[model samples]
Target: MRITKTLWNKASAARLLLYKRDASPPSNAVRVLGAMLGLQFDFEEPDLLQMEHRTPEYRKINPMATIPVLKDGDFTLAESHAINLYLLSKYGGEQKEVLYPSDLKTRAVIDQCLFFDAGMLFRRLLEVSQPAFIGKIDSASSTHIRNIEEGYGIVETYLESSPYVAGDRLTLADISLGCTVAGLEGINIQ
Candidate 1:
């Protein structure tokens, strides 16, 4: 009975970890980490078309109404970059060092890459997308286009130095940037 209880608790924790209130790469980043770590997920995707994210209850989970709100037990986390670090640290176990290394220099480089994605790359995506979401424009404006291209240039510069976004190996920064890049490509961002 004691062992069974322990198994149950572990299973419960994983289930809670898998609980995804919103969808997208930010959320997908966490899911990818979980998947790579061999954890089972229970995705609870909300309908964005119907404004499901703006509901009162949904707002309780994330007042900002952001995608990929992760609910683990009683703890809720927002922001893809933050969640990636938290999940990687808490559940990464043996794989933590591989994904997010411990050395300060390596970790600092990784942190810089993540920051680039969140502040520059991902924000550029949002700038081009929000206007479309509200029907303010049919597509990205010239300035938005320039901004997107500028973001691509930044990524290119990062790769010119190393194979990965952070260093020689993959890291949380790559996961977050990959998702944002995919979204841009899906819209034919060139």
Candidate 2:
């Protein structure tokens, strides 16, 4: 992704806030998409270990107090998947058509991929992470490992038919799912 002068200028002027860090897969996805769109965002890192997300102010912005919150002016949105979709729909021009197509069937497939990431891949990851973070477990259980491997198996099957997750071209689905896989890798979950 080459950053053009126009993109740089637009990014400099945009007022966007992304509450995220590199350690989080969903956060990483949104950051990549924002960069692709030439959108600059003020990053606010909420320390989960420090309980910063539990603060009253942060909770007001997001009741769930999750990371990767997007604040565009007065409008605030939670969840990285939704934020990615919103960013593409609002700022993506004709040049970004491959990232998100307008055709109903194609879009539906992309949507399904997004849901799969959220419901299956990320959900299984959370099962492993949540326990470790709260000191419930020192390592991933056999069940947790099996679930993640199954998720990857599904992704492997999907890739057999297309160069990317959803189709031949890169889409928001790839961004979303890629981040989740990257997160798992970062922790040496395999």
Candidate 3:
């Protein structure tokens, strides 16, 4: 829980659009941001904006109509990945080296994992698990099970190689996949 010393010391206003869940992926993003910036999040679970990204009022904050929008001072950002990176770069010091990396080759490996999580791993999990979470998709269906299984197999294969997804040292990639993918285990997906 060692957050950024300078970031914690600075007085800043922070707000996030998110839901209530222990393992909510966005919360992990916020947690990572807090760790990166060393600042406590002024979290607000705005009911009016809850999943109402298309509303005109909400569009002012993020025209893309995305959840987990972040507002700090005059700046606003959307996309958890982008926000996490921004926080780390702008506020983090030596710790940024661990999360984002300094070496080109090591950074590439982390980038690969982040890309896989955002582009493929998470997409598939959300597709199959969406139904299960919302009671729309039958969790026991062979197709649903297979989809989850396939995704899990892919992650497990990679995890078998390293203690974490991106390798020995934990990175943003682990934070992303760990919170999102690991939650699927509730339905025995893992």
By TM-score, the best candidate is 2
Q: If both were scored by lDDT, which would come out higher, candidate 1 or candidate 2?
A: 2
lDDT to native, each model = 0.76, 0.85, 0.67
lDDT of 3 by residue, 86-178 (tens): 777766667799888888988888888777777776666667655565667565577666876777787798889999887888888888777
Candidate 1 structure quality by residue, lDDT tens digits, 67-120: 777777788887878887877777677779999999999999888988888888
Return the clash pairs for model 3, or none. Answer: 4-38, 131-137
Candidate 3 stretches with Cα past 4 Å from truth are 1-23, 46-51, 132-135, 138-140, 188-190
TM-score to true structure, per model: 0.86, 0.90, 0.78
Write candidate 2's Cα lDDT for 45-161 as tens digits. 988888899899999999988888998878899999999988877777753577989888888999999999988999998888877887888888788889989999999999999
- Report the Cα lDDT for candidate 1: 0.76
lDDT of 1 at 90: 72
Point out the higher-scoring one by TM-score: 1 or 3.
Answer: 1
Give the TM-score (vs. native) of candidate 1: 0.86
Per model, state how many residue pairs clash: 0, 0, 2
lDDT measured at residue 87 in model 1 versus the true structure, 0 to 100: 71
All models, RMSD in angstroms = 3.5, 3.0, 4.0
Residue pairs with backbone atoms closer than 3 Å in model 2 (clashes): none
